[model samples]
Target: VVPGINEIYDPRTKTWSEGPERYFPTYPALFLTQGGEIFYTGSNAGYGPADEGREPGLWDLESNTFTEVGGLRDADQLETSASLLLPPAQEQRFMVLGGGGVGESEESTERTAIIDLTEENPRYRDGPPLPQGTRYLSSVILPDDTVFTSGGSEDYRGRGDSDILKAQFYDPATNSFRPAADPTVGRNYHSEALLLPDGRVATFGSDPLFGDADNTRMGEFEKRIEVYTPPYLHDGREERRPVLGEGPERAAPGETVTFATGQPGRIAEARLMRPSAVTHTTDVEQRSLQLEVRRGAGGVSFTLPEDPSLVPPGWYMLFVSDEEGTPSEATWIQIGEGLAKD
Candidate 1:
């Protein structure tokens, strides 16, 4: 597979096939929308020219129609920015955060933009800004419906000790950010962040351009990883995370699967989280959906949504959260394909 080409691999058929030929910049921030179209958030790697292929829009592969979404502030500075599909997949909202100017121009933006696809003319609106201009910022979705964003440099590649150690938790419901514990290591270019099964976030990899303020010394690749325990998992909330005792290995869409939980009374919500396959700043498969939870005599039960587009057929991490918003260590479950999906 090369640039501007998409190769689709089907595990069931054990074969590879060519997909539609479309031109997209490297590492384009693409998300799977419910209507079966791909949404390009205009966030991409530091390769393309600032004038082309950096507009946020819906790429309808079926008809090859590109509907552009406007209202991005620092449109020219989108390279190395971060974008994500907001939690509770049903919301159909997206957010794009800090980015740098194209091809190492030493320009960066703290601008953040959000769009709600459910709107008739869905265009991006300005969200809160970061503390400073940043690039190569890493973000991950927490099970508690908050997005944890951390570690980026103000310059193109931490060329002048410009790495920002700050981190923040962005709440979707409140549309605000609260400060989080600063990371010990400064992560810049090539850094990554992903959620662990135990509700902790593990961050890895950083390759700065220079080791010192002066441009003479070469930089080193950071191999040490840092695991962050979110606030929900602390303050005696660790023991309160709901535990799934018994359940089936697989469940069909819309089928009710019951499970015995350690603390059923405290159980409030269930989520189907797709384990992410992340590249430095992009994970196209990261998604989470709410499951219909029912309390009964034997135990708690969850019903997967009937819509195949909403709950795609695949293996997912099942997490049950308590009233305190603490989630259990994930249990793997396979969601069977529905008849509606191809």
Candidate 2:
């Protein structure tokens, strides 16, 4: 069986597990919902008609299942994209929007569809179609109920296939489209937007490694990253906030580690998700620090306890809850006594 689109590991046994059987396109952007469900859209149904192969759909994680929502998938829907709504509200259901399928007999679509996941029978509903047609664009949901879509090709066949600078934002409440800040360069097929802790959004991708001139997908790949600061989020005053950056790769036993946070803030607690070694399911081990937010000229720093026995040599994550008691960001730390030691 094909492995699920996005796979998770048990962490205990160090074994990995796939989500569910959703006829996923294997290479499409996936969004994980607050409810732990996975939804992916956009793909060509290799066996179907040109249009039949390209449809946008989703898969549920709890039941280990997949469901085809509603989309015009066909051979033409070559590239698919999906982004889960962040800061999801009770009234607003999970929202996913994308480009692909067919907008015309011989080409891909400029149309966008919204799925109301909160509905009992979640189905696709009409969303404001892109003012300009496009395909293979990246989508991201912001904290303010704003969905941003950027990059992608417009009118693939006739337009000479140049990258588009075009991008837009959608307001779920009004079901309307509004213009958002545009990127300096035109990119499609390889781009992604990530919401930053300061309420700004960062978009990366279009790496040359991921896509090429002949095959757009092969040249846009890159390890480089970029940030996008939204004007609407500026507060004039800069407040010290903590952002959990990427964590350690592996941890052995007895290694002193520094946590990752963009700006320093109070680090109150810590947790270790132990690898099962057998099943790989993560088992939670809570270590109480109850530390207070100490201010410094440079920034805040949290010191790990001296006992190396507290953590075994393996992969573990350090979750630091801020003074507010809300878990800020997780830092992956490896505890060990050797080369794996940082």
Top candidate when judged by lDDT against the true structure: 1
lDDT of each: 0.87, 0.47
TM-score between candidate 1 and the true structure: 0.95
The lDDT, on a scale of 0 to 1, for candidate 1 is: 0.87
Each model's TM-score, in the order given?
A: 0.95, 0.53
Off by over 4 Å in 1: 338-342
- Tens digits of per-residue lDDT, candidate 2, 279-318, equal 0000012121222244444344344433443343454444
Evaluate residue 164 in candidate 2 and report its C-alpha lDDT on the 0 to 100 scale. 62
Q: Residue 102, candidate 2: how far off, in angstroms?
A: 8.8
| Candidate 2 segments whose C-alpha is farther than 4 A from its true place | 1-8, 17-23, 28-67, 70-78, 86-92, 101-106, 155-161, 207-226, 234-342
Full-model lDDT, candidate 2: 0.47
* Residue-pair clashes per candidate: 0, 52
For TM-score, the strongest prediction is 1
